[model samples]
Target: MNVSTASARVPEGWREVNRAMWDERVPVHVAGSFYDLDGFRTRRDDLRDFEKAEVGDVTGKSLLHLQCHIGTDTLSWIHHGAARVVGLDFSAPAVEAARALAADLGHGPERAAFVTGDVYDAAETVPEPSYDIVYTGLGALCWLPDIRRWAETAASLVKPGGFLYLAEFHPFTEALDDATGTRIVRDYFSRGAQVWDEPGTYADQDAVTVNNRSVEWQHTLGDVVSALAAAGLRIEFLHEHDVSLFPRFDNFEVRDGYHRFPEDHPRIPLIYSLKAAKS
Candidate 1:
């Protein structure tokens, strides 16, 4: 789907801005050493250990992956035996890349589908209460402005007994400034607006451009759980981990596909995964 026009509906011009950013970041991410496409193709569990442990046994289940950038993890679910997988993202370029990858792997529309659309508009475009699992991965929640709307959409997509799974960066970690390698710059509990000047992306370090203005919102851990619960989903499990899927902090060490802060680093949670089921 061509999402160029849909980008106009995004509040605060974020749709267009994020589209451009993801478009530019696609090739960089595909070529980046961090992704390791070849390795991923050979191994099904290329994702974080927490993901493997939390999102267990998806065999023959229908899954909807929201904010599925380039559809890497979404495809991984297919490899793990998901009967059908639908990947939704706002970036046309990322969706194109994902389609190409799926084709390369011999997966057709019968087994997997990719759509380019805003998360808020996804339910309008696709069937709701049709999926057994609604999944979103790390770094996805920050891009969205409202958790309440997200939870509503998530609940709508899941079947009566279906579950929603999310593995995201912890709100506490978002308060720290890892760029300067110095000190805590933002308030941990502050539910304030954050304006970012960004020519590049978190995955790419070499990218530099003129359009470098975007806004993001921070939600505390309490905010995330409460929003989902209020949306009529029952919390099944909530797990916090000290390690992350990527190097979130400058002083972190990468060991065995996980990133951890220094030995004496504060015990603040770095990543968290949650599972909620619709009653």
Candidate 2:
């Protein structure tokens, strides 16, 4: 289901399509090997090394995770000593899964909360913002159509002197095809929605079969940085990496548990981390 244009608002008609697709993916992801719930039961920290390094320690802090699918990373923050944590997702099933995972992990509502709502409504829906850390990780921003509104909401959610941390697939990487990682299959700048209709979710491609359709927007590095700056957030640092946390392409190699390009492939930035503070 293709939308009229890429420049639509956050609660546009196409968002329903994306939401339905994500709702269907929740069950598949929960039972899939990609998440490895068994492994997570023992090895609690699911955050990537870059995320840890970029966001730093969350000990004794209040954290809010936006678009937190299933809450693995949100729970990881709790294990890392966050005093309070809240995870928000548009999909009710994902939120339910997250709450169940928290309970199974022995975390109670006093320590963790999961809310089901559109991220665009987070500023108003989430129990009073002003969290110590507002964290957003990879494979998130593409789902949203409005970066400026997202930046403003993230800034509003952060407490004074606190920061908004983002770790995401770089726009440059998004422009390349996942099969070869060399073909320019997507626009790098803001354009109309990139519509897709595939058979499965990214977590487990063959685990289930459904006509999974979604709409994504392409955003440049400039679009991201400028949005935050416009929202009255001070840019701390923007770091680009050649390695990604996932094997986005067929030729990617696993290094130290992370998926990176093979040595022979041309070096290109695959991911980016940005930290901005509310003044």
Candidate 3:
């Protein structure tokens, strides 16, 4: 699929827009309860069960976390015994907060390093065939306009036999109307046309501004798998979960740090985690 359109450009203006939005949200998100800095320090693995189970054994391994907003999850890997970690994102404010948090928690510069750049740009900027693990968390994939470039960049970052791990919201869940306060409203198999013009963010409910025009492209589960496979990453495992990390549906309930529709509700996968090895 062609990702370059009138809307999806990597020009100076588009990057500036993304930077401003992220800068505005960084402070709000850091103070918000969703990130929970205290919980991150005390219960490092609490937010990363999917990664912990699928990515397995990172002791003495070098890990690169892409689109690592605020670096909470990246630091979590360090606590889980990763030897070295580098967190990269496009937002200056987010990376600053990540660095501050790492220093405050005593992870220090020796264990973790934060870099600010576009994911594709950082892939080239960071040392190739150096990282033992490449990782990204939820709410990451939708921001990008292309999946093929993302997969290619991911493949280039990891060493031969190293792995890439991603745990993100299922594409099917994106079809549903998050603001309708009702049922699903969007298409599940839409290949063309982009979702545009969205105000406010999923993280904070109170901070709504005019800078809400983000272009998002949707890809099916098959599309993701095929892209990674074509990039020479062998699929290790793909796991679908019934529970989501956030309240996806309006009627869902948050229980035990997970959101779930009622037992009688329609069965739809809310989240999916994948592990692929570069062999």
For TM-score, the strongest prediction is: 2
Please give, for residues 102-136, the per-residue lDDT of candidate 1 as tens digits.
88788997888998889988887654446999999
Output the lDDT of residue 35, model 1.
Answer: 74
lDDT of candidate 1 vs native?
0.79
Count of clashes in candidate 1: 0
Q: 1 or 2, which is superior by lDDT? A: 2
Report the C-alpha displacement of residue 42, candidate 2, in angstroms: 1.4
Q: TM-score of model 2 relative to the true fold?
A: 0.93
Which clashing pairs does model 1 show?
none
Whole-model lDDT, model 2: 0.86
Alpha-carbon local distance difference test for all models: 0.79, 0.86, 0.79
lDDT of 1 at 188: 67
- Which candidate model has the greater lDDT, 2 or 3? 2
lDDT of 3 by residue, 190-247 (tens): 6553534555567776676566655556778998899899999999999998888777
Tell me each candidate's TM-score. 0.89, 0.93, 0.89
In model 1, where do residues sit more than 4 Å from their true spots?
Answer: 1-11, 127-129, 177-184
Show model 2 residue runs off by greater than 4 Å.
1-12, 177-179, 183-186
- On lDDT, the leading prediction is 2
